[model samples]
Target: MRKTIIGLDLDRESSQISYYSERSMEPETVSIQENQDRYLIPTPSDLFTLIEGKVELGQMTLANFLKTCIGYIGPSVKPENVCIMITMKEITLAWADALRNACQMIGIPGEAVFLQTHRESFCCYTLNQKKELWIHRVALFEYEDTKISSYIMDIDYHTKPALVRAETGKSINLGRQGARSQEQWNEQRDARFLEMIEEVFQNDTFSAVFLIGDSFDKTWAVESLQYLWSNRRRRVYQGRNLYTKGACYAAMQRMDIGKRLDDFLYQSEDLVEHNLSMQMEHRGKQSTHMLINAGTNWFEAEYTCEFILDDTDEVVIYARSMMGGEAESYSIVLKNLPERPKRTTRLQMRLKFISQGRCKVTIRDLGFGEFYPASGKVWESVLEV
Candidate 1:
C-alpha cells in the first residue's frame, strides 16, 4: 500500500484537512458533515492563546485534536506511513515546535511532519494546476469576515530553477459597519470590489484568479463577478479548500511523488537567500567549506565547525547570493589572544541565522590539546546579508 499523504490547514478559528486520493490522484477535502460540503472544524478558542503560558497543556490539546482528525481518514491507516504538511497564515519557530511536538505525541515521526506559510501553499496549489492556468501571473482574492485581501504570484523563468514568488497585496474592510440596508451595502461593496479588481488587473495579464472564502457569491458581487469572469476572460474559481489541497501537494513534492514542480523553487519569507562558506585546509589542500546553505529556514539554519588558525587572528565568512553574485566576506577579529605558534591555535566556530538577512557568529578559542593551554576566550559578531 502507498503512504498516506495529508495536508492540514490549521488556524486559530478553524481547521481543514485534505488527503491525497490514490484512486482520483488528487487531494480530496475532508468534510465534517456526513452528507454536506462542510470542510471546517471549529477549533478551541483558547488553543493558541494558552500556548504562551502552559506549553505542555497546549501541545496535549493539539495532539488530541490531531488524533481526532486522523481518525476521520480511515481505520486501516498507520501513523508510520503518514506524511502531514501543516500550513498556516504565518508560522513562528515556537509554533512550529509546538506542532511538531504534537505530532510526535501521536506517534508521527519528526521527519514526516512539515510546516509552511499560506503563501507557499498558494504557490504549490497554483503551480500544480495545468500549465496554461499558471503560465502567466495568477491572482487570488480572499474574503473573510467582512474583509477582503488580494495577492499576486509571478514566476521568473529567467532564473535557473525558476523562482516562484507570491506577495500579499491590497486589503480592505468590506463589512457592514454602518449599513443603511442590505441592498445599499451590497451595491457599495460591488463598486469597491470592482475598483480593487481594476487597480490590480490594470496593465497586467492574468491567466487565472482564485476566490477563497465561504461567503463569496454572485449575490453581492454581481458587477465584480461578471468583470472577473467576462472582461478578464480568465478562469475564475471559488472554493475554501485551496490551502489544504496546496499543503497536500507540498507533502507530495517533498516526498518525490510528483515531478510537476521539480524545476521550480518557492522562496518564502523564512528562507535564506545567501550561502555562507569559508576557506579552510582540508586533506592538505585549501578548499571552500560550506557553513550554512541557502534555501534553509532561518530558524533551523545553524552550523558548527572546528578549525586551526593558519596564520591570522581573524575569522572570515563569505556570503554569496543564490541569485548569482560575487561572494562578500565579513571578518571578525580575535582580541587579546595568547601568543601561540602558527597552526597551533584551534578554534570552534558557530553560525546561526536570526532572520532572513541577519546571522549571528561566534568563535571560541580551544587550545591545541594542552600544548598551548586554554585561554577560555570567545568572540562574537553579527553578519548582515
Candidate 2:
C-alpha cells in the first residue's frame, strides 16, 4: 500500500493542510471548500452564516473544527501505514492527546502523529532547501491581522539537530486599511513606515526572505515592498502555501522515504527533530548504540536504557550531527554507588528530551544479585548542548 501523510498548519485565525502520497510523488495543498479554488480555509466563528439552527457537518468553526480535525483527516489516512502531523502556534496537552486518540481509531500508529510548533515548519522548510540558499541568514516576514512578524532563521554549523533556530514574532502597527488603503494619502505616514522597516532591517543581512500574508499584495504594501526589494540580499519569495508545504516536508521526513535531507534538522523552542546517540565499548570491543532516533517529536522522545555499570562510573553519549563538525559528546556521571565491586551496580539511564534547549538525563542504580540489592539511588543531569 502507498504511504499517506497529512501535514496540518493550524492557528486560531486560519488553517491549511498539505497531503503527500506515494503515488502522487509530490505534496499538494488540500482545499476545504466544496467549489472554491483555494487552499487555506478560514475558521472564523462568524463564517457559519449559511446554516441556521441546524449546524452543517463540514462547517468550519474555531471550536469544533480543531477538535474534529483528526477525524476529518481520517479519510485521507491509510490503514496500517500512515502518518499525521500537526504544526500549530500553541496547543494544550489535552488537545494533542485527543489528536493521538483520533489517530489510533483510524489505524495510524500513536507514535506516528507528530506535533510541533509552527516556527518549526518554517525551519524545516528553509533547511530542506538547497544549501546554496544558506549562504547568509534566511528570513521570513509573516503579516497577519495588521501585525508583522519577522523571523530570522539562524544557522549554526556547530549544533546537530536544533541547528536551525527562528528569531521572530516582531510586531508593528501597520494597521488594517488605514494609510495603506488611501491611494492619495499624505506621504508622511508612508515615509515613517518605510523608515521603521529600514530600522528593523538595518542591522541584519538575509540571503532569502519569504513574504507571507493577505496584506502582502502590491496595493497594500507598495512602500514596504519597495523597501524590502531594494535592501534585500537576494530573492524575496511570496506565498500563502509555504508553511503548509513546509509541514508536508516535515511529514515526509518522518516516513523515511521520498524526503531527502542534504543535512537539515528542524528544531524549535519545544521540538527536537534529531536523534541523540552514543558510542561505547563492550567486552574490550567498541560499538555504537542509539539512544534517541531523529525525526521524533520532542513530546514523545522519552526513552529508557538500563545497563550495569562498567569498570568506569562515567557514561558518555554523543549527538551524532549530520554532515560536518565534531559529534557533541555528553559525559554522564553515575556517582554514589554502594561502594561494591565493578559491574555489581546496575544502572538504568534515561534520556528525555525536555525542550529544544536541553535533554534531561536520569541515572538510577538497580542492583545485581541478592547480595547487592537495588540501592534506589539516582543521579540527574541536563544536556543543554
Candidate 3:
C-alpha cells in the first residue's frame, strides 16, 4: 500500500489541510467542499484555549479538531499509512505535546506526527520549488488579522551542505476598525504596505515573493502589488495554503516518498546547533558514537544508553556545530565511583536539552549484575552547547 503524506497548517485564526500520495503530482489542499477552492477551516476557539495552556473541564477540543481536519483526507488513507506534519504560527514544548496527544487520540501514532514553525514551513515550501525560485533570496509577506509581517529567507552557499535561514523583518498593524469607508481603508493600507515592500525589497534581490493571508488581494493591495511586480525577474504569488503544502513536503522528505531534500538544511531559531556524541568502543572498535544530532528541535532531542566503563574515570562528550567545525569536548570526572576492575562498572547515561544552548546529562551507577551490587548513586551535569 502506498503511504499517505499529510500536512496540516494550524493557527488561531484558521487552519488548512493538504495531502500527497504516489498518484498525485503535487500536494493538494483538502477543502471542506468538494470541487471547490475553499481550503481554510475555521479553528475552534476551544482549541486555542487548550494551546494557551488552559484546558477546560471535559473538553477534547484539540482531538476533535484534528479528527475533523484529517477526515477530509477520505477513507482510502488509513491512519497507519499516514504521516502528518503540522505547521503552526508559534510552537512551545507544551503546544507540541498537545498536538502529538491530539493526533494520538485520533488514532495517529505519535511517531507518525511532526511539528514545525511557520518560518520553517516557509523555508520547506521554498526549498521544494524550482532552483531559480530560491537560488537567490526569497521574501514572504503574511498579513494576519490587522498586522502584516515580512520574512526573508537566504541560502548560504559557502557551507558544504548549504544553510537556509529565514529572518523576521518589519511588521506593522493596518488598523481598519475605525475606518469610515472601505476606499479610505484600502488606500491607507496600500500606502503602508507599499512602503513596507519598498523598504524590504531595497535591501536584497528577491527572486520570488509570496503574499499570504485572506486579507491580501489585488483590490486592496493594488499599489503594493504593482510595486512588487515592477521587477520582471521576481515572481509573485498569493495563497493561504503555503504552510499546509510545505508541511506536506516536509512529510514527504522525511518518509523519502518522492523528492529527496538532503542538500539544504534549514536552520530555524529553535534548532539545536550542536551534535552531542562520545568516543567509545563499539564491537571492540573505538569510534565516535553520536547520542544526539544537530538540526533538531532542542525540546525533542534526547538520547539514552548503557555502556561499560573501560579504563576511564572520566566521561568525555564532544559537541560539534552543524556547519562543520572542530568539535568541542566536555568532560565529567567520576571521582566517587567505586574502585572496581577496569571495564567492570556499568553506567547508564541520558542526555536531554534544557534549551537550544543547554543540555543536561545524567549518569547512574548500575554496577556489574550480581557480582558488584548497584551503588544507587547518580551524577548530573549541564553542558553549554
Candidate 4:
C-alpha cells in the first residue's frame, strides 16, 4: 500500500511540519493549524486545559495546540562515524506519538509519520545535492537565546563513498560569557572563540560553514563575525522553517516519493551501523543467519527464531560495526537446557537491543514435539558486543 509520508519537526517556540503527496509535484510546508502562516505554527505553554478537572487533549485543534504548547522534545543529533544506539526521553516519544495521532485525525496512517530533530534536518537540507555536499564537508554554527554550539559533518571514505562522520560540540552560554557591551564582548570573546575554531580546523577540514541562529543575523552588533570566513566559504541564514522543509525532503526520501538519496548515509547516534549473525549447523552443513542487520534503526531491530541445539548449548555470534573495522564475535550460553536426544531439543531465541552496549537475548525451550513434549522452561541472556 502507498504510504502517506510526512516529516514532523518539533521545536520549542513553534513546531512546523512538511509533507509530500503524489498529487503535488513538490513537498508542501504548512502550518499545523488553520489561519496561521503556511509554514509556521504557534506553540503555547499550556496546550491542554482541564474542563471540570478532565484534560481534553484529543480536540480537533490538537495540532494547533501543539503549535503553541509543546516544548522541544528531541535534541539535535550529529551524524558520526560510530554506530551507536541512542535512546530518547519518554517525553520525546510522547511528542512523536501525539503527532502520529494528529496524522491519524487527518486521514493519514500513523505508521507513515517520521520525526526529525532540527540538527538532523540541517544535514538532510545540505546533503541532497548531487556532488556538492559530498564534495565539501560542512559545519553548522548555531547561535540561540544565550548559547553557541557547532556541528561538523564530513564525508567518510573508510569503505567506498558511503557516509558522513559527525561531531557535535557542547553549547556555551554567550550571554554569561560576553562582556557588558557588544564591542567589549567581541573583544573578550574573539580570542577564545577563534581558538576553538582554530583547534577544530587544525584537526579537520571544511569547505563551507553554515551560520545559523538569530545571533548571526545581527553580525553588525558582533565583531567575531569577521573570523567566520577567514579562508573558507560561509553561508548565513536565520530562521526556523528550513528544518521543516528539510524534514519534508527526508520524508520523501524515506518513502522514495522523489529522487532517491544514495550517497549520504548518516551514521548518527540514532542510526545503527552493525549486524549480528550466527553460524550454526543446519542438518549436516553450516548456515548463517542474521539476528540484526546493519543500517537498520536499532529501535526497530528485533527478531525471533526457533532452532535445534546441535552439540552445545553455547552459540557464537559475530558482528561488524559501522566503523568498518574487524569482525568481533560474541558467545552466548543457554545455561539450562533439558538433556535429550541429539537434534531433538527445540529452542526459541529472541534478539533485541536495550542500548548501544546491551542486546537483550531470550531463549526458551519448546521441546521437540508431542513425543518430547514441552519443558515450560526459559532462559534470559545479555549479549555485549
TM-score of each: 0.82, 0.64, 0.86, 0.67
Segments of candidate 4 deviating more than 4 angstroms: 11-14, 23-26, 38-120, 130-134, 157-159, 176-208, 211-216, 219-233, 242-248, 268-274, 281-284, 295-300, 320-328, 339-345, 367-376
Deviation from native of the Cα of residue 203 in model 1, angstroms: 2.3
Please list the C-alpha lDDT of all candidates, in the order they appear: 0.86, 0.67, 0.86, 0.59
**Candidate 1 lDDT by residue in tens digits, 55-112:** 6789988888888777677777777788999998877666776887899999988888
Q: Give lDDT for model 1.
A: 0.86
Query: For residues 164-272, what per-residue lDDT tens digits would candidate 2 score against the true structure?
Result: 6777645576554454537544243355446656765677776787888776667546786687788545778898877777778888887875657656555554555
- From the highest TM-score down, the ranking of the candidates is 3, 1, 4, 2
Of candidates 3 and 2, the better by lDDT: 3
Model 2 has an lDDT value of 0.67
- Tell me how far the alpha carbon of residue 282 in candidate 3 is from the true structure, in angstroms, after superposition: 2.4
Which has the better TM-score: candidate 1, or candidate 2? 1
Model 4 lDDT vs. the true structure?
0.59
| Clash count in backbone of candidate 4 | 9
Question: Which regions of candidate 3 fall more than 4 Å away from where they truly are?
Answer: 54-60, 105-107, 309-315, 323-326, 331-348, 362-381
Give the per-residue lDDT of model 4 (tens digit) for 269-319: 755567788887766888888788776545555678988877887767788
